[model samples]
Every structure is written in structure tokens, then in C-alpha cells.
Target: MSTSPVTLLTEDDSWEFLRTQSVGRLATAVGGEAEIFPVSFAAGDGVVYFRTRPGTKLVELTVNSRVAFEADEWGEDVATSVVVKGTARILETDAELAAARGTGLVSFQNDDKNVWVSITPTEVSGRRIARG
Candidate 1:
């Protein structure tokens, strides 16, 4: 009998994997209410960037800056998942806005997504497992 291989990914490895992914779930909690939203994102320089318009997700994160984000991918024989816990804030500075524009993130929604949110991860962890 053969057992599946499991591996823990390093911070750098996790960020590298995250850079290859586009869509992730953004988790936020405020006033004891937890909410999660699917967001298209870009990862670079140890941060995650996503665009959103004024709405629940934006409002929730504003109330509570602490957030959790997750992205995953699966291959024929292996699967991987990355989770990022951090603080999220809206971009305001010109330099910050310029950096975000360079990320080249594309929104899946047709609605105007003019606001950019940057997630600076305090902790990032990931794992990969092989199919048995």
C-alpha cells in the first residue's frame, strides 16, 4: 500500500504559489459577524492586492482590518492550499496606487471596481499533498 505525500510550504514558497493564482477568498469579521467573498487578486512583494467597490466586503473590512485570505490549486496528482492572515487597508497614497496598478489584477465583475485593497500578511502558511 502507498500513502500520499504531504509537505508544508515555506513562506517564500507560499507567496510564490500565491503569485500564480488569481482568485481567492477574502475573509473578514466585524461585530461578531464573519463574511467571506471571492476576489480576484495579485500577489507580490509579500502582499496581496484586490479591487472592489463600496459594498459589504469593503464595509466589513473597514470596521475590522484583520482578515484572512485563501487561494488553492490542484493538479492531476497533487493539491495545494495557501492561507494568509493579515491586515487589510484601502489604498490612498499615490505611490501605493501606482504600485497596485503595476500588479495587473483583473476584476471578474463587470461592475466598476475602482477601490484597491492591500492585504499585508502577518502570517502565511500552505501545504501540498499528493494523491495516493
Candidate 2:
């Protein structure tokens, strides 16, 4: 198999690509082990938001707010990956919930997603792997 050359993506390109995606992996590290959860998220206003039922993610985020989020788009000939380093927090205000109401971020599974979490990014970067 032939591998493609990797190119670093610009900040603007990265953000634009992220805005076009709705899902990403949220990586969190607790005491000793690290976990990654697939999340259905919305990209807007320099932050990403997602809904989840109360579980490990909620528990872990409560313990450590620092987290990393990644989303990627891939094709047979090219692939793009974006990494976001941010702080995760549960949305607890009426205004926050009100703003998140119509983001079109829907869950793929049949779980009760009552808790809303938002990841505000401190660093945003990306790379593209393409055949040259």
C-alpha cells in the first residue's frame, strides 16, 4: 500500500472544515487511564457542543475539564484530520440551553441525552493526508 504525504492545514481551513462536521472523538484522561468517546457535536462560535446521557463522560469531565477533541474527513484519495484541545463543561444555564436548542446536533443512538456538554477550544490544528 502506498502512503500519502501529510500537509499541515491552516487555521482558517481547519476551522472551516470543522464547521462542516457533526461528529468527533472526545479524549479524556483521568487518574491512570484515558478514554475516548464518539460524540455527535455541533461546531459554532469557536466551540463544539454535544448531548449525552449521564455516564463516564460526565463523571470524567467533572473530574478533569481538560480534554482533546478530534474530527476528520476522509476519502479514498485524501483525508483530513482536525484536533482541538479544549476545556469541557456541562451547560447549566437557561441561556446556554436556549442557544443550543436548534444546533441540529442529534444523537445516533436511542439514548436519553439530557446533559449538554460544550468544549471550548484553546488550540485548533489539522493536517491533510493526500496523494501527491
Candidate 3:
């Protein structure tokens, strides 16, 4: 085993890590139960955007806006994880939809994405473990 130490990531570093990832897990609560789903996203600034078909995922967000999102990267000798606590909102306006379309956010599965959800993170934290 590699003797590595875990270190807290700086805020800037955390955001940088998030921007580098296109796939992440979005965590939401449904009927008091936490559910997580993998989503393809586009990250920039302080917001993370994902495209999803109108279904349970959209309904779940309407039921509860609070959510947690995470993405990670792993290497032979180092690993990093970033978590985001945020609120999910559906983009309703035409401008919002158009803007999202411009980002080229895609869903993992082949489905018609009628709705785009924007997660404005309230808090972001990350950690990195690297070989000492």
C-alpha cells in the first residue's frame, strides 16, 4: 500500500476539479430516501448544468430543491473527490433553455432532453489523497 496522506482541497482547486469533469453523481432526496444518479454535466462559473428527460429526476427536483453533487478523479498514486451542496432549479425561460443548449450538455442515455436543471451550489468541498 502506498503511504499517502489526505489533504483538504482549496476552494479554487475544488472548482477547478469540478470543471474538469463531465460526468458526476447527482444526489437528491425522494420521499425521505436519498437517491443518486449519474449524469453528464457542463461546469463553469459556480453553476453545474445537466440535461434530463422529463421523468422522475425532474419530479424529484421539484419535490426537493436541495441536492448534493459529486465528481472524482483517480490516478495511480493520487485521488480526489469534490462534493457540492446546492439547490436544483429547472430552466423555464426560453433564454435559459437556449443558453443551456449552447453549452452542449448531454445526457448519458439516448433520450430527448426536454428539461435542463441548473444546480447552484451553496457550498463546495473537496479532498485529495496523494502518496507521501
Q: Pick the candidate with the highest lDDT.
A: 1
- Model 1 spans with C-alpha error above 4 angstroms: 1-4
Give stretches of model 2 more than 4 Å off. Answer: 1-4
lDDT of 3 by residue, 25-89 (tens): 99999888999989999876678889887788888999999999999989999999999999999
Q: Which 10 successive residues of model 1 have the least lDDT summed?
A: 103-112
- lDDT (10s digit) by residue, model 1, range 72-92: 999999999999999999999
Models sorted by lDDT, best on top: 1, 2, 3
CA-lDDT, candidates in order: 0.93, 0.88, 0.88
Q: How do the predictions measure up, each by TM-score?
A: 0.94, 0.90, 0.88
Checking candidate 2 for backbone clashes, the offending pairs are: none
